[model samples]
Target: MDKAMQKVNERLTPEGKMDVLSKWEVHTLLTASKERFSYEFRACSLAVLNTGSTEDNAKAVLEQYPDFKIEVIQQERGIKLQVSNAPAQAFVDGEMITGIKEHLFSVLRDIVFVGNEIETNPRFDLEKTEDITNAIFHILRNAKALQTEVLPNIAVCWGGHSINRIEYEYTKEVGYQLGLRYLNVCTGCGPGAMKGPMKGANIAHAKQRITDGRYIGITEPGIIAAESPNPIVNELIILPDIEKRLEAFVRMGHGVIVFPGGPGTAEEILYLLGILLHPKNKEVPFPMILTGPKSSEDYFKQIHHFIESTLGFEAQQKYKIIIDDPALVAREMRSMIEDVSDYRRSTSDAYYYNWILHIDKEFQLPFIPSHENMSQLELHKDQETHLLAANLRRAFSGIVAGNVKEEGILSIEENGKFQISGDEEIMTPLDKLLSAFVEQKRMKLPGSEYIPCYEIVKPRNLS
Candidate 1:
């Protein structure tokens, strides 16, 4: 209860799960926080405990807790986390809060499993397309995210963390409707639109006397520090990267509802459209809807225009745009989920996981948004529509990295902004859309001065 105790030092045990681990798993996890090995485990663990954080800068969070450290202490029955300099908010009355502790263990559980089983195990040749997906399935299965005997009712919500009050309220209303219909909520598990829906669904589930409601949050190591899980999330699963995280959303949810957002949301929109646009997935009855408050109609128009201009009209046919009607959104999704269920049943696919959808290897591969890679992206229109979407998704992803991610922020600071260039047909609309996000102050939280992280090089000819 003193200023010195603000940074907690505690030996914490697992709450419900992850209480036991093998000697090999513990040894492999011991290198987690080492600098040469990467701060992925350390950073993700911090984010799990730093649940109520409002800052979206990963570098700032790391620097804010430079003295923080955690180690795995092996025991006969189980293992314990020797945590020092952890955020005090995660603890009350000198004991770590139950949810945060559980989240922390979930982080540990994933790190150990992924390091020892998936990554080190040669069975998953990540370069192969199907292997990547199978690896994702194994990761989710290991985390117990894919349930048995569950119907098609999970709705994956996508939006920005830096949205306005109106948009946030709209997400909550939509979530409430979904919960009233016995549907669960899945999200990127950050703030703004992601948090709103789960918060709304929690209240509705209580009203309906639903005790086993699931508020699932799927994230990855790269973005978790910047966008920590909201308190409403009862189930949290951390994949290896953003690409896997995106796939997890589509694979787990029966339907997707998109709320208004910035570049990160734009990235997600493009990723989904790219997959659904694939000829192989044309027969798949995946339900996708884009909706927001009436005030956000122009925003939707802007996004729609960008999509049409880039991926062509074919991409526009993939989803519906419903404005200002949460009930209607829920009803449409609930009805469409019946189609999803039927399709899955007919195809003999599992109701909890979408095995029929085809995601190209391009979407599965991790895109490192370095300066050279960002500049070399083939953002022209001569390629396949889905391929074009994949590039655009990467472009926005790079911009997102430079905006808030630690590595991207450091790259920007060291080498200046990333340079994104392509044909005028793609660059012009792309520039317009990005500029609008900057103008609306969607790139960063309110009261923070937004800066453009990448320069759009508009081509004069088809070069």
Candidate 2:
């Protein structure tokens, strides 16, 4: 369909979601379309429409469709979205695709809720650590993500969106194995590894005669534009920011299975490790596994090297490296999740959320990936190990933003690449791991040239 033919102007009601959306909740969208909230809502909406976009540049997509607009109109029945200048791909035969429509409402539901209920309400103090977690609980609860009836089955999968066929297929097989064991899948809700596992598990769920398979995709505003919600994401949730998004994954997931990915994936690993390394959470049976095809073995090795060298052996112990065995990976994850179930049951913790685990305020607070913030990150070994992991997670997060997020990319253009300086011991391996990602085309889609968005500077005394 031509660009003009693709321009959709329609009034759409909710499908499989938010059919009874409150006027006070979603109306925040129409009112929020003024400043920061407007940008986030519009950007996320466009990202949902650009579902299959190959170009992972958020700014480029916004520029491509400058006229896109959405409005929330309330009625006695519920809220209906009047969207115009929407991408044609989101619709089929003049009707919006059911999945895309569902995702669109999810964005509307979340963006407005955070802007209106969570952020604006005096009850939620986002600055305080406990309050932040409480806000996340409310957000997830609002999304109907917290189900008390089910046991621990949600496996949060993390991997790159630009993965090769081998790695992608491996994710699918692993997911299929998980599905045969009646496990559900959750991810960043994008493509590549995220889509692979869900696709694999979907077929397995079918074969096993299971109909209620949950494919939960959790994302935030910053990353959504570049990594749009893939079609397989039956349940799409938009957290207000990346920090909450990461916390949501850990809070809700019973286990984590990581596939080969780039900086963003590494950022996720660091975030999870930072939390697991805390003294208060040592006994928590939150299983984590890293697996990939044999060819992608080196990728996992590089990740292991980065973690061990920077955060020490303790961080390395937090996860297992399982190579090329989908069945074993699934078996291991399923078995471990049972232990998590027992731990939760015994502790009187909610089955839907991990309430006992402690996340430091350092990790709970949002980090702006600005040039100054990126340069000033404390990447040395002087601080606590978990603190160091938190800083390292910030570094990788900045690179991810530079690589895809619209504001980060534009900032890179206006100011320049981010400069990262730390001790030589950490700098060498850090630079090497990033270089390997570049060479492997894990930083971006294959064949798209990558310009280093950040420079790793060694301590002046050593280099």
Model 1's alpha-carbon lDDT is: 0.89
lDDT of 1 at 67: 88
- Candidate 2 lDDT, tens digit per residue, 160-263? 99999999999999999999999999999999999999999999999999998999999999899878999999999999889999999999999999999999
Question: Model 1, 200: alpha-carbon shift in Å?
Answer: 0.6
RMSD of each: 1.7, 1.7
TM-scores for all predictions: 0.97, 0.97
Please report, as a residue range, the 10-residue window in candidate 1 with the lowest summed lDDT: 29-38
- What candidate 1 gets wrong by more than 4 Å, as runs, is 1-5, 31-38
- After superposing candidate 2, which stretches have Cα over 4 Å from the reference? 1-5, 21-29, 33-36
By summed lDDT, which 10 consecutive residues of candidate 2 come out lowest? 21-30
Q: What are the Cα lDDT values of the candidates?
A: 0.89, 0.90
Give the CA lDDT, 0 to 100, for residue 170 in model 1.
95
